[model samples]
Target chain A: MGFDGDDTLWHNESIFSMTQERFRTILGGIDAAEVDRRLLEAERRNLGLFGYGIKGFVLSMIETAIEVTGGEVDARDIQTLIDCGKSMLAHPVELLDGVAETVEYLANSHRLVLITKGDLFDQESKIARSGLADLFDRIEIVSEKDPETYRRVLARHDIEPERFLMVGNSVRSDILPVLEIGGQAVHVPYHITWAHEHVEPPAEGYRRIEGMAELTGVIAAL
Target chain B: MGFDGDDTLWHNESIFSMTQERFRTILGGIDAAEVDRRLLEAERRNLGLFGYGIKGFVLSMIETAIEVTGGEVDARDIQTLIDCGKSMLAHPVELLDGVAETVEYLANSHRLVLITKGDLFDQESKIARSGLADLFDRIEIVSEKDPETYRRVLARHDIEPERFLMVGNSVRSDILPVLEIGGQAVHVPYHITWAHEHVEPPAEGYRRIEGMAELTGVIAAL
Candidate 1:
């Protein structure tokens, strides 16, 4: 079994944040919180239009900025918004409750691997900081945690797809990909998720948990 | 003017880290320092192969594990390294010194925007946390900050590249693209960099600063 570090185990976001805040600050004096609420609503409404990813967030922030600012904003604000988009690429990684114990218990039963994506050095440094580096049998820091990552990690451990189960927060990168390879999947939802990783209707054989606290219970059941 | 978030204002690495203490704990009666030195040597030597992303660092860790264990490490040990990688993806945003000041100062005279790429919501939240969000006029989250993002952002700004200077750490995304559009580029190196953002044969017109702390001096001179 495995997990995706960002979102699943900890908070992770893309880089749309900087611009969003800049917009709020520049167009302050109004109810920016309500504006933010509306923008978030617009984002959810336009999820289908933009899909998830950097491009979608960029356009949405611009749209939201323009909508809330009532076209009083300028190219400078849009430019700053774009800049914020780039700077806002991640969420702070705080481990979901019980991540450690679940992994510890699962370690005795199934092979546990941690698969994730993003800048390599940043990822590695975080692992060292987390102080839970001794849990897994294999760690794969892939460019993208797709089916390829899952298959390769499983293959390295000589784990069959049928025998393996992927426990993660993302249905897009983690669960879906593993399921594609005929492996089982367990999803543990984080408080927030990247819009891009949203799966409209989750596929079959996918097990979900509200938080990592319930992870061991589900995995033990599996 | 705009700033690059990763590797400019912040220290970001895509590689998972192996601490010296962990090495000593794993391999008893061995020269752990030498092990560290050898690992560094391998990383420096293989930096070319990995090229600064998750794929590269994962390969580095795998190679390091094989070398230190002499190909005899158990699944648990291998997983330990793997977990280190999973742990790596969860690092918090570590902003570089003077970056906040630079953004704040620039916000006064110039139109500031955030031009960056990566995940969407993750980026937005980090900007809000950074406390410098009020300074910029806009934030743009992008998927890939290639010429396209520059082109779109520039067109929106109604400012030619000659009039707009893009300040960032990545040669590929920040400097080269700005230069490609006839804009000025100020490169402020961060403590660490993502692998894929690395550029070879530094292009002309790209001014380099030792770090973000010196950014103000260089910008004032410009």
Candidate 2:
């Protein structure tokens, strides 16, 4: 069994949402939608250059701040943006409701691997703080969670896609990719999703569960 | 045999040095020594928070700029810093002299694994662009190259430290840690080294080669 980090087993997207809100306030007077759009544009432009993570997001925010403000952004505001990133890095990893119990329950009978994508230190720190790291048989912090990445990971661990099952919150990142490579996946929607991770659900291929509470039942039924 | 990326296989610190010089010019009038001191301090301070890579380095640079300028650093300068980071990310991966030939030569007879430590995406992109990726039997991009990390990697790959050999430029990262775990290592010094990666050479137990040109000779003798 493979578990996706971020919004899958913890409160992740909500933190990003909160940070974006804070960013909106920092760039006050600008239309929130415009701020968001410009920030997202900077993020997309930088995605290939900076990749993903709070550090990249903060950098993009700084870039967008300068762009939106016509290069008149306060240095202190830039400092504020940097501070936001630091705090986000130091943000406590809060496991979602019933996550600890469900993960612990499943670990008893299965080899659970935590496969996450993000900044290495940030992800590792979160895993350490998540307090549930011990339940995982193996932990993979990847650069991205695409089909090729999943294929490489599964091959490395000597597992066939047919026997593998992935659980996560992002359909774009966690579900579609796994199913594309012949693996079973369960989609457990989170209340908040990043714009980059938003994608239409596949018409038919995977199971959808309300949350971690239904994970074990789905796994058993599989 | 395990090889370190960055300075080991290609040019890395030189790019950082050039960027730091540009930073100095941007913050002109500040004592270059003071700028270097403050930037290094910021980097060390944020190391735990930002980890390693151009993103974190750029963040530290921006933070230090704010500090040196007393929160009055120009927003355009901040954008310049961001641009510096983007260019660094887009910078070409230039392999050190003889690295390609040496790595390829060894790969024919030895299981060469590339073990590097840094941001996941940055390191992955570097490896891909290095053109030597196909020669590596396995590639491990870690957050830190501590003794415990080396041990974990070796164990995962079923490599006993006594039989494992590591080649890299940083003694702190690639040599001492591997030596501490009973692994044999060869130090191939780069022309420049990052301050964070500098450490006194181990008193004994590892061979020192001036560069990749001498790598295969040392390996054969080992």
Q: Top DockQ: which candidate number? A: 2
Query: Per-residue lDDT tens digits of candidate 1, residues A1-222?
Result: 776777666555522344566667866766877767767876776553333433345555655655665655554555454445444433344666787777777778766677766544455545655655678766666555668767767876788899887777777887888888999888877656654457764756788778777877776676
Estimate the lDDT of model 2: 0.92
Task: Give the per-residue lDDT digits (tens) of candidate 1, residues B89-189.
Answer: 34566677777777777788888888766443345545666777788777765545777678877776676777888888778788887888788888776
Runs off by more than 4 Å, candidate 1: A13-23, A27-92, B1-222
lDDT tens per residue, model 2, A19-121: 9999999888899999999988889889998888999999999999999999999999999999999999999999988799999999999889999999998
* Candidate 2 global TM-score: 0.98
Per-prediction interface RMSD in Å: 21.7, 0.7
Give per-residue CA lDDT, model 2, range B7-125, as digits (tens): 88889899999999999999997999999999999999999999999999999999999999999899999999999999999999998899889988999899988999889999999
Using all chains and alpha carbons, the TM-scores for the candidates as numbered come to 0.41, 0.98
